[model samples]
Target: MTSSPDTQPIVVGIDPDPTQWLALAWAVDEATRRRLPLRLAHAREAPPSKYRTAELTPAWETWDEALRTLGTRALEQVEAFVRDRRPEVEVSVLLVEGDAASVLRGQA
Candidate 1:
């Protein structure tokens, strides 16, 4: 089937983890084969367990900083990989806030 360049065939959800990158790579290959655009979406999620609790000196700041670093690195890696491997696939990056479902629904 023919596809439109303006329409993305796959929307990849990226998180603060390496697994998301693997999924993105797979989606890129699939979109390329289908001749469709690839959209990258990154979301920031709070961990289930509190990684940092407020203390005399405010330890939450440390936890927040660490999570931010992880998320930033993950996004950067995804962007670089997409640019290098699928430059012709029409890639777009999205920065989203909140949980995955909420952000995705809002985007939709």
Candidate 2:
């Protein structure tokens, strides 16, 4: 039986790392098989860095842009993976703006 959004089992706690993609993909497949919902959670906070007061330059901007572009590309890869492998899975993407592990743990 298909589950409603409110009643569906939610597969949550996905990390924004390439290594975690397999687990996320599996979760989506499992959710599809069980007729549940899949939640893809990602954190948007800047990564912990030791040098916070460093001066910014044009090169720094370019590097930041590259990183942002890479992240977007990586997320698209995840979307493509789910769409291709678990087309029937009901999925929701959440972009939380804080420590990912902490936020996800609280959600669970």
Candidate 3:
């Protein structure tokens, strides 16, 4: 019997580095075989700033926007990669705002 939608998800950590693509591909195949939903996650850490205590300076805002854009692009790339390789598998994208290990641990 297939697992229900509320079952534990098959999570794949993705990044801008090409090496992570291999892990994603493998996860996609496993998820498809198991008939489980795939969650593609990309975590981004904020950069250090001198105005961090300034309550939102223009520089901080710009940096934040850049980080968000990077996360978006990474997720989109992985989503496309998964779709091309395993179109039948259910997939979801997660753009997390924190360190990779912490984000993954929280998901677990």
Candidate 4:
């Protein structure tokens, strides 16, 4: 029987590195075989802004927006891959702000 989205989804921590999509491929295969939904989670943490007494620097919002943009791109890329590979499988994306490990742990 197929599982619903509310059921235990096959969670995979998506890597920003395109070369490291093997894990995501495996997760998609497993989720497809098990007839479960796939949750692709991408986590990004912005660098700490250094306060310079007399230097012009972008605002915190800039940094946050950049991180979110990159994270969203990464998730979209993988989500497309998974969908193309297995159109029958339900795919979901999660763009989160935090350390990868901590955010993925919360996904579990």
Candidate 5:
């Protein structure tokens, strides 16, 4: 794995799934070993409603809040995971409103 120095922090795009954490583990390991900061980013955009034709969607605000809540929970879980492994490693989190790919790219 390529190591980032102190100047550039290693960024990791964390998903909503708490059970899936291999990527986070690798990112934390690399950051601690390379002595760089770790960034945990999760995008928060309401997913497309499958019931558009039936007009059976929840309130717009409610859906948006749900997405943000999920993103926040995911970030917290990953942060705890990182802290548990290496307490000394620096870690930051970003919960942005956009697509996952775009959010991560913007972090760069």
Candidate 6:
């Protein structure tokens, strides 16, 4: 869905890495200055595995859980970082499941 008139539109790429913190900081500052909303997104890659379909059933579930947890943590950290720096800025978090490049492209 598209953003509403009241909704601000500033999208930023986020990761568990420290480098993302710099980008997030910049995006948060810009969003705050422009009175826009900030969208922090993290893309997860689910690559095909060598395991057989039957063997992958349980493994897939475990892997999916791990990825979800990691994504949640990353989003939480980024959100906290933004709030700590710019508490008044509006921020939203997104966790997209797919290849990083493709997910980012789709969002754009």
lDDT of 1: 0.70
lDDT of 6 at 31: 88
- What lDDT score goes with residue 72 in model 4? 92
Model 3 error, position 3 (Å): 5.5
Backbone clash pairs in model 3 (N, Cα, C under 3 Å; residues 3+ apart or in different chains), count: 0
lDDT for predicted candidate 2 compared with the true structure: 0.65
Q: Of 3 and 5, which scores higher on lDDT? A: 3
**Residues forming the 10-long window of minimal summed lDDT in candidate 4:** 48-57
Q: Tens digits of per-residue lDDT for model 3 on 6-85?
A: 78879888878777588888899999889898888888886655658677777788988899998899888889888899
Q: Could you give candidate 6's per-residue lDDT for residues 35-58 as a string of tens digits?
A: 888888898778676663886798
Among all candidates shown, the one with the greatest TM-score: 3
Instruction: Please tell me which predicted candidate would have the highest lDDT against the true structure.
Output: 4
Ranking by lDDT: 4, 3, 5, 6, 1, 2
C-alpha local distance difference test of each model: 0.70, 0.65, 0.83, 0.84, 0.82, 0.82
What is candidate 2's lDDT per residue for 1-108, written digit by digit as tens? 356657645646554476867777778778877788676666555544653345645555676666566556666667677778877776666655567678677656
**1-108, model 4: which lDDT tens digit per residue?**
357546888899998788999999999999988999989998887554465223434566676788899889999899989988999888889998788898888988
Angstrom error of the Cα, residue 92, model 2: value is 1.4
lDDT per residue as tens, model 1, 1-108: 345655644788886566646787898888788887776776767655554344523555665667677767877888788778877776767765578888767655
**What does the lDDT come to for candidate 5?**
0.82
Cα RMSDs, all models: 4.6, 3.7, 2.5, 2.9, 4.7, 3.3
* Per-residue lDDT over 14-93 for candidate 5, one digit per residue giving the tens place of the 0 to 100 score: 97776788888999999988888888999886456563433545566677778888888988988998999988888989
100: Cα error in model 2, Å: 1.9
Of the two candidates 2 and 4, the one with more favorable lDDT, higher being better, is 4
